[model samples]
Target: MEARERVVKMGALKHHSIVRRILTLVVSMVILIALVNSAVINTMIYRQLLTEYKSKGIAISQSIADSASDILLFRDPATIQSLLDQHLTINGVAYLVLEDAENNIVAHTFVPQVPQALRTIYAGKRTTTATTAFHRLPGLGNVYEISQPILFGEIGIIHVGMSLKPIHHSMLKVVAILIPILLVVLITALFVFRSRLRFVTRPLVELADYTKHLAGHNFEQSLPEQGAIRAIAAEHNDEVGRLSETIVSLEDAIMTYIGDLKRTTAAKQKIESELMIARQIQLGMLPKSTDNTAFETVKIASYLEPAREVGGDFFDFINVGEDVYIVAGDVSGKGVSAAIFMATTMMLIKAKAQEHIPPQELMVSVNNQLIALNENMLFVTVFCGKINRYTGIFSYVNAGHPAPFIKRKNEALEIPLTGGMALGVDYHHYYQQRELQLENNDTICLYTDGISEAMDVAQNQYTEARLAQCIGQSKAVSAHELMDDILQDVRIFSDGADQSDDITVLLASWCHASASVSSELGVHFTNDLSEIAKLHQVVDIYSQANGLTKTLQHNLKLVLEELIANTISYGYRDHEIHDIKVFFTVVNNALNMRIEDDGIPFNPLEDAPEVDHSLSLEDMPVGGLGIHIVKNFVDTIHYERQDHLNVVEFTKSLGETA
Candidate 1:
């Protein structure tokens, strides 16, 4: 702890005072080196001064010795003394002395004698060779003296003293002048280096404080503005400046991230609340799993589970009129929006189914409603069917959803769910209804894509083939057991992976109670007279297959022709296309013919005139002949008005003769 405190304190102090020490060390060392170099230069200059003065002194002494050599050899001192006197007054020449080989002074340049500081220097070297030496002259600060043997003389010694007055004194004067100036310059440099310290340390100190705030998670702290620190950072292209800029950038990122986090958190809460409510509403819209709503001859089982809190998958079964409608579908999204679309779609299906609407027309109307209301471009794929409880005929329309699987005791496979795009694509789109006559113990399995697309941890799908195979194994089971087993298999296939979509499955089993079988063949025709030949062809085929005689076939053809001709003539008022449907069915060897027309409402069974046998042929009504003949060919005739259209049904027993 102590060590750490020291380090922290050092770091804090380093922000302010670190550069001062560096500059002090560098500037102090530079000033000290300058002073040392000046001293060294002064010494070299003094030495050079001494050497020049000594050389001049030696030359003067040699001139004196050369002049005295000839005179002293002849004992002529008078001329030597005159030469000495002439050179004595020259600068830095303290003395000039010449002696004979007998030790007798011949000439001297000094006025009296050697100075006290120069006496020992003059006597220091007595060799015959020349030599120079420095000595302290009493009045002069320093001097150099040289002694030489005059080579021009026979046997004479010369001694010269050169005072180092001007050169040495000038060098000393320079040292005295430079020491104070150098002290002033060093002080000024220290002040300048100290004042510039803020430029380098201010950013570092600001960054230190900023980092401390960040370390404490104090996100609310305001950073330095465009003040001194910022300006310094901008001006100075250094490590401290770059670090400060980076800190400012980090602060902006953190601020932005915090704002986004708050918004995201609030949005998440709102969505979760809405999803909770929507989930309840969506689940409530479906039929309860405990409520197995089915007729005695038909058993039903369904399951719906959402991947999200609310899902787009839904299934419903409603009893409308004499038929039961089962709807299984999926909308194109997830969560709240998808759940809303699913609920809307289901409600529409139920409303139309209650009116005994056929699946094709029901799909078209539902699609148009969705398209009109869908501002979000939402769509649904639905498989809705109407099951005739008494006859076990399943009529359904596939509106871009997955096709239902028809599993009997013998076969299991998927049929194509063709016709019509997904809802909300186009209001004018057409959907076709298909009919599947269910035998005993036949199961219709309707589902959404969730079943086949259920994935494993490895992302392998539980495909349609696998679903079919699983259902095939459970073909003999009850509807509830079959659905349970299939769901369990799906769970196994998932391998603990989370569901990615809404899984919905509806199983409806149908078994006809009666032993006799029924079959229907239908024919569609336009208003053209040429199409009547196709009606005739249907009549002959049904007649031969059901063991009807040729006469009965002819009579049936005539009855159909009269009904179709009446519909084509009077049913539609405008010049437009119309569909007239004729159904021929054999039930327990009884021929049942049902004709439907999308035309003006007219009950032919009630409006046909009773033939008047008492009148002559010319007095009878023309239209009564065809109706009268049709009334006699069949045992019973029935008529009903539905949807502004007409339905005519007739039945004939197999044992009846023509």
Candidate 2:
């Protein structure tokens, strides 16, 4: 039964409207013909049987009427009985009866039995015209009667009745004939319908299965259109063929797109890699380190940070005998092209520096070189200077660059060297230079515009005023210390905004010979107090050998005391005993001392608290005044914290006036 249900469902899935219509027409025609034939057959058979019965009744009534007239005229009851017996002998006749006027029975016939009740009913009513009776006999079946008037001057009434057994038998025979014919028609229709449905539905079932596989992304299968199914395919040419063609086209397009994307990605990666290499080469062009102690009293500290892959800011320093040349410049643009032009400008400056020319002459030569190679119309703003370390004089040329600051003693001021267009403007342009004196403890700071033009997170520029203020506050620090402090301050102000350009600072200080003697002393000590006493003994030997003055002796003693106390106290804050070394030198009659310690770095000079002179001695802080007094007596001091050693140097002139 389950298999039969599945077959029926499969037939429904594949059934076509045309085949369904034909099956419906066949079934309807068969049912309509059966209904019409059954109705006509029943109607004709009933009418024929009723007519025959009426005719038989008429004939029997006429015969009985004649017999009744004879009986009444001749009074022969035997004749009537004979007539009734004759009629009863015929087939399907059950009984016969006759009644006269006044309800008196004339004659009666019974075949194998008639009920006494029927006889009584016949005797109860009488008429002069015809009368009829019907009865069911026990062995003779249904009966019919007919009667007629005697009409011998209306002497008596006559009636006749007969059976209808033949009509019932005929109806049963008709039903027996029609039932087998209907069964044969129904059986033939079932076989014929199954065969036709197979022809129509088999190809459709195959097509449905193929479509299911295709929906699951399996495009490799194809359908065979043949026979009756091919006729359907020929009608509309099959939508499945169009779908397969579209899939092929889409696959081709996807492959082409993927190939193009891969090629484009490779090309982009190659370009990016080349740009990185170019950036590295640009960085490699800058100077690494300067010649050590190359100039008498000059130091330069520079910093460069590019905002992008490359930059255009540069600085160069050259020493020519008694004079040192310094150049700090910024090109007009940024990136690789600007970096190329900056390199060219540095080469020109180097050539000019070696020629022993004045700053104005050097700028004129460098400008000619730049303008000759200025096909791209590139330009650079530069501040170039040539300083005489021996005379403490500087001659500089400014070409649209920010003015350099000069810290002379306690006063910090900007140099007034102004005039000349930037390089690459005109080939034969004249450059001007201004000369100024650098006093003792004076600092000449040369820088690029990147310093003063650096911006903070708020987009505010680190203006020249702020730069000057930072420089003034750090005047007591050495050249390197001052530069470090300024960079730290700028970084704090900028708050992680990129250093937009190069930062280059060069500081030069002049120390006279007479002021150098009061500063030079050296000592060495151990963890033992005897070793410290021995260090004092060695210092006395050197002071006596050099014939030092009382004031010089007092200053040297104080400097040594501070140096030893710092090494013994905070330098070994973990209480680890260590050795210390000190060296003294006199260059051109100026005293210089160098002290070294194998302890943690602690620079008393830098960390010293500022003294509030307004407060009285009783109210004054006692801890920081030691380094302050040491600084007041010395002309110049420098400290370096190198691996496991703190090196501090002190310098002063020997003359009483210093």
Candidate 2 regions exceeding 4 Å error are 1-278, 289-294, 408-411, 498-658
TM-score of each: 0.49, 0.43
| C-alpha-based local distance difference test score of model 1 | 0.77
Residue lDDT tens for model 1, 112-218: 66555444443433466777666666665565667677653347677676766677677979888877888788888877877688667766766665566565564
Please give the lDDT score at residue 461 for candidate 2: 93
Best TM-score goes to which candidate?
1
Report every candidate's CA lDDT: 0.77, 0.69
| TM accuracy, model 1 | 0.49
Clashes within 3 Å, all models in order: 0, 28
